[model samples]
Target: MPAVTVSNPLALPRLPEPGLDARPRPVLAVTTAPSGVEGEGFPVRRAFAGVNQSHLDPFIMMDQMGEVDYQAGEPKGTPWHPHRGFETVTYIIDGTFVHQDSHGGGGVITDGDTQWMTAGSGLLHIETPPESLVMSGGLFHGLQLWVNLPASDKMIKPKYQDIRGGSVKLLASEDGGALVRLIAGGIGGYEGPGITHTPITMTHVSVNPGAQVTLPWRSDFNALAYSLAGSGSAGIERRPFHLGQAVVFGDGDSLTIRADEVQDSRSANFEVVLLGGQPIREPVAWYGPFVMNSHRELQQAMEDFQAGRLGTVPTS
Candidate 1:
């Protein structure tokens, strides 16, 4: 990867009207992405937020991992792996992850930090635990999102963005407890500060229990929400979902929402990753550590890896 070059935000594609589907398209309620391949010694992938199902566009995939074992004094880390033709974004809410890659960039990311890396052509990277955090049994909660590179920019030089927590804005709802912080796109006039290759809306929101909120959405884009902490209710049908679940929306510009009455005195905080872009609809040939548009492309990527083409670290 190279030094970060701040550029004007990329323009978004036109939207499309919703069409009746045979089923509810899984509603993103509790779907999973193709994650969790065998790691160096261990592999435990907790959740796959979205991938081909909801985001056939500017976004590719998203995953959530935690040093969640509350068994005091032990943190976890995913060792080295290879990624070609895409980017890996790590947002830390708790604990830390030390990342070193073949593309020449390496660093330790602390809590409340966002490290967005673009592995354009190819890269070999390792994510390990810092001795202090792992040995001390540090708490860890974080997410990793993958953004697809445009065809023209797929092979461009790799790079990274180490966005500090303070760099992102935080917005609170009227109740003071229900809040929203725009991460990628704009929210209530708070435009996120970071590089983007697509028009996306990724925000984190937490609503107080029983608070009724009218959340907004794009008229022509596919929209959905995931619960991070407490149960959330949305839709004309008044659907309810708990933690580790997502709810997909039908055609609508906004939603009627409320917190579950089942839990009245707990925090309803959550990480909501909103995304919408013109569907690439391109064929996807995905295997462990590789994602390509076609089987031939997949085969080529494998050959490249076998030939040691992914032997260097990325620049940041």
Candidate 2:
């Protein structure tokens, strides 16, 4: 529960590559209304890196949980479950989410807080609406992303990082037209507070109409942008995207996102989550919440969970 501050405030210098400025990354594909499915007990919209298209290396899946309002006393959430061989990044935007894991780690993540949990080996956990929220009835909105672990670090040890909203660095445009929240990795010269096993950048950006920002990224990493709220255009193609939509980018060392028109009246801005990471092109054997390099390893994970070796969560 320590604060993570920006260690550097200057943009990382890039080597001069021919045509780097001239070449803006192009949007490889646009996914709208990615197949919806019920996860645990809550409704979730699978954006990318799911069963159908799991090739986005280092990124396993992204789920946008209920932008829905729940009535008082309604039960809605994921019960106890086990995960291994990866990390789960939960960014809560509006409602209170209480978490408890078998490792005796848990917390309440409300507006703008992020819970980064590494189920490196194995762990059982539950994510649900806080008793207060469930009894009062209110809006709940958030995003959960799964990041893959390299084969070498698959069983390094479980860890957790609970990042508060205020602790995250917010960068504003010189013209005051855009704001970027650096959650993890580096943006320009500023860096987010969350540490990572694999190299990646997680940014939540808000852009006003007619405003645009070009973000430098590692050329070798795969990139994806998810439209969480409002609509916007991205890449050299200036592809138009809407809420619940995800845009996958092709090879490039940088990305440009522009807000063509404001979609929210209250904020008069377009919002998006940009994620990029170095690709781990190793083979994947996935089953339920477990992801391993081979099927045999996945079986071992199941066996461990069944044998009670992963630990147990408190019932109360």
Candidate 3:
């Protein structure tokens, strides 16, 4: 996709191999995402569906939005809606999106840009394609990830961050055969631009054919990998996976991924999104748009939203 790329990944900073003492995480599970329609009928792959919540912990859900090319007048987006007790990270890889929220946060994010919105207490928000994009539709591909906020921060004020593509920290594998786009969190002393309330790391990796990459991970954080395109294998046992699949790893200090020597013609490299976060380990009472610690709290959120305490949608 058109997220971000360099003419020579070899020129980028390299990630050193994990030390001999680093424990290699084992692949716990591999699941294929089910396709679904979302946000006014736009296509999406439910990336985290069917995975056990205990393994997901701090993460609630993820949707891989549109790797499809839209025809003129075919672009779609979400209607204004309310959310509470979590964060929404929308990363645009190949197209454009416009976001606006009642908290006075709004922006247009195009290729490789990210919009991070923390709907902590509550807020009304909407996302759509720009008028121009709707008129001359082209490729649209991206991911929207939902991160849970711990109870302590769940009711804090909402926040927003507009992270541009150029701000991402780029690095390569030790052998220079893979590109790592650090979107948020830290790795080997390099930090990404997006700020988060939870301890987490997000990276997009593209591994060349026959290449292998090993990443040093935080032992305290849970590890996950989702395939965006092409073929690859994960962990010490080399469990194979392809596009639209997600991998969960057992406890360890490192993660290993290897690209197939011969990939399908559609993709040149094995593209994956790596995510890990410190588990919240608290009760998760989640409903349509609200996530809270208890059923009573969820009821309160729904009542508050209906009463417009979340904030009113702005006038055009």
Candidate 4:
């Protein structure tokens, strides 16, 4: 195992914007009431890739896991599964998860930790609650997002980025009422540690009551903000967003978000994950865990998986 490199927070280049006075993007649409489905064994709320919608271009799917109080002995977690031609980004908000992949990569991701795995070529992996946590029974919450690779790089190579909570760069608003954690892109001049195959911005934001932050974004990329906790208004439209809602933005060079008054001490802050990337704009043939450009490629992926060519996790 190699030591994870942490980028100097002060040396991060700011995300460039064409104009400082550019108008903020408007709210294009709000997606709420995500479809509920059981994944592997645990429950999940899928924002995209549901029966109603699929493939947000460069992005394949987004799932909010648990957020449920699991009683002791409840069946939980995703067992061994195969994936190809895409990347899986897992951000742990609460609880601990153990991950193991066929490539002999395995580790635990605790609160605020992130696991970015590229299933390029192909691989088998399993994500489950650690034995200690499962026996104790507690609250579990997190987000799992799937990012697509361009056809040219779909089978480049497999890679893993295990980001610890303390290593993530945190940028604070001048007023100290807001903080942005860069997970896989530039935000407020601080760049995240994870290297991405596709250009994208992935951030976790926390805003105190009545505080606001305006951040620059590329106009050519597709952007979305998912409210994880509390309530707030987003974009130029000032559209109100609540927990479990995802707001998609229209074209613009920037976006604004403001935290509303807290209802109580428990809900004194608002949190959201902001993400965007240029669209791949390519044909997609998705089946189960494999996402390819055509049906023939999808069939090949299955064949490879059945033949055990994807490798196996070492037992020792």
Candidate 5:
């Protein structure tokens, strides 16, 4: 759960506190992620499984990959796959992952690092544990978020960004009760390193026990909070949320999160990922591996992929 951390949060820039008139976001709904197996039989929690698409505009789906400790010879990874009309943001929190793509954009990302891959036109890629990590077998936990590309940019050039842990913009709650790692987008004029086709904000937060954090949010952007560890409450109403639960927030100028006085033994702090994005509000034709604006486009993507127009896996 060490996505990013510091010995003393007070040493960081203090996050802007909400104004007195700030409207607290209301908790609209909460959904507990369902566990299932993903590529190569690795466990994952489907973070957006039961959430409404409208609330997740500009974002397709998210997978909380393994909070598991794999033994030697047990580590697994995804086989080569193709994607188009979207971007994949893979953030590694506890382990190392090696990424390779047909576009020659790939690298090794470990603790607190991120790999942002835009399969704009199309590309073949694979994600796997590094040989060393696979052999040693240790903690592996991360998040993969699918960000949809708007129709106009769906066919643009593909690209990649390797965002290192240290590149994240770190901030502390107004009272220094929480640590925030801004991976992408802006929060109160502070921007992250991730460059995206769609407007969005992605952050990992760690709230100390009994602490509360209030963050100003763009009213036009839909807000969401997914618990990564420990117990906490969301919104000004104090709606309870726990690990693997996704909290959808209603319209407001800001959002709130509170950590329980006593956290579960598994985690020392309440960990959550806050996500928000400007709604694309376009028709989505999403199938396995491809996301498009229309079913016909999805069909074209399949044709292109099968015909090897998406690029072949490198022989090397």
Candidate 6:
């Protein structure tokens, strides 16, 4: 008998704009999820959490919450919780987030701050409180993403990163398009900051109105786009994708994209989340706040927290 060595799924090879002259694929489906949870708090509202859309890539969950009341003394967020089998990435857009952990790491994440938490073996932490943001109502927007971990790496050491917005490279075009990012993974042609434990890429981009941008991608990698700020055109089928939606591109021998800004968004900032990665199609046992491979593993995580053997602190 031979030992079975788990291998990482192939993530899409990131390619630069296909020089704007490549052939394109039409998007097959343009779907939308009207409402979903913002997080542990907030009542169910019209949040564009990427839950209802794309699973084309390793991008599992997306939660975009705004109107997050960041009063100086009041805290609004999830309490001490556990996560395994995946990592959660948070980006603050309007306010700040006070993060603490079981690893003696804690900090105040202000707008543009990026925190990438790898909950490999398992992790118990509290997010929010000691308010990092103070403000009245407007758009306290931000994003939450869950990156799946391969079975072999599920018990790897947990890690965290605080990549400031200014630290991330932002490139702009003469027109309306721009790219801000690289919280993780690499976009070779574009020098982005932040690195990841596994194979993945997360970036924010804008497609100028009526201007088409072609992106080169690998046949093996999974790719998907999220409609964040403005309406736009995307996907292999090249159909219409409105705000608060995500389009998961199908896997084929070709990876092509052609996007033109919608008429109403011609002058608007067509914001979208560009993500691609290898899929860990392993079985997932997800609980309220923790995710493991089986019920027994999840039970161990909870038991560790109760017994205090899971030595980690949420005080970065």
Taking all chains together, each candidate's TM-score versus the true structure is 0.78, 0.89, 0.98, 0.89, 0.99, 0.78
Clashes per candidate, residues 3 or more apart or on different chains = 14, 3, 0, 0, 0, 22
Model 3, 1-316: lDDT tens per residue? 7569898999999998889999999999999999999979999999999899999989999999979899999999999999999999999999999999998888999999989999999999999999999999999999999999999999999989999999999999999999999999987778888888999999999999999999999999999999988998999799999999999999999999999999894669999999999998999999988999999999999999999999999997
Candidate order by decreasing TM-score? 5, 3, 2, 4, 1, 6
C-alpha lDDT score of every prediction, in listed order: 0.59, 0.79, 0.93, 0.78, 0.94, 0.60
lDDT, residue 117, model 6: 84
Residue lDDT tens for model 6, 1-316? 0011112211222345544554444455555746655446642223333343335435566676553444454446676766777788887765667777777665777666788888787667777634333333323557778777767887888888878877765544333244334455555466556676557777766555655445555455667776665665675446677667767666543333334545353225566667777776767776766667789988987887777766655343
lDDT ranking, high to low: 5, 3, 2, 4, 6, 1
Point out where model 4 deviates above 4 Å: 1-20, 49-55, 264-267, 313-316
Q: Where is model 1 poorest over a 10-residue stretch in terms of lDDT?
A: 1-10
Instruction: Assess candidate 6 and give its lDDT.
Output: 0.60
Best by lDDT: 5
Cα RMSD (angstroms) for every candidate in the order listed: 7.7, 4.5, 0.9, 4.6, 0.7, 8.9
How far residue 199's Cα lies from its native spot in candidate 4, in Å, is 0.5
Error (Å) of candidate 6 at residue 55 is: 3.7
Candidate with more favorable, higher lDDT: 2 or 5: 5
Which runs of model 6 end up more than 4 angstroms from their true locations? Answer: 1-16, 19-28, 37-40, 43-57, 67-75, 129-138, 172-176, 252-267, 311-316
Error of 1 at 300 (Å): 1.4
In model 5, which regions exceed 4 Å deviation? Answer: none
lDDT, candidate 5, 162-217, per-residue tens: 99999999999999999999999988778999998899999999999999999999
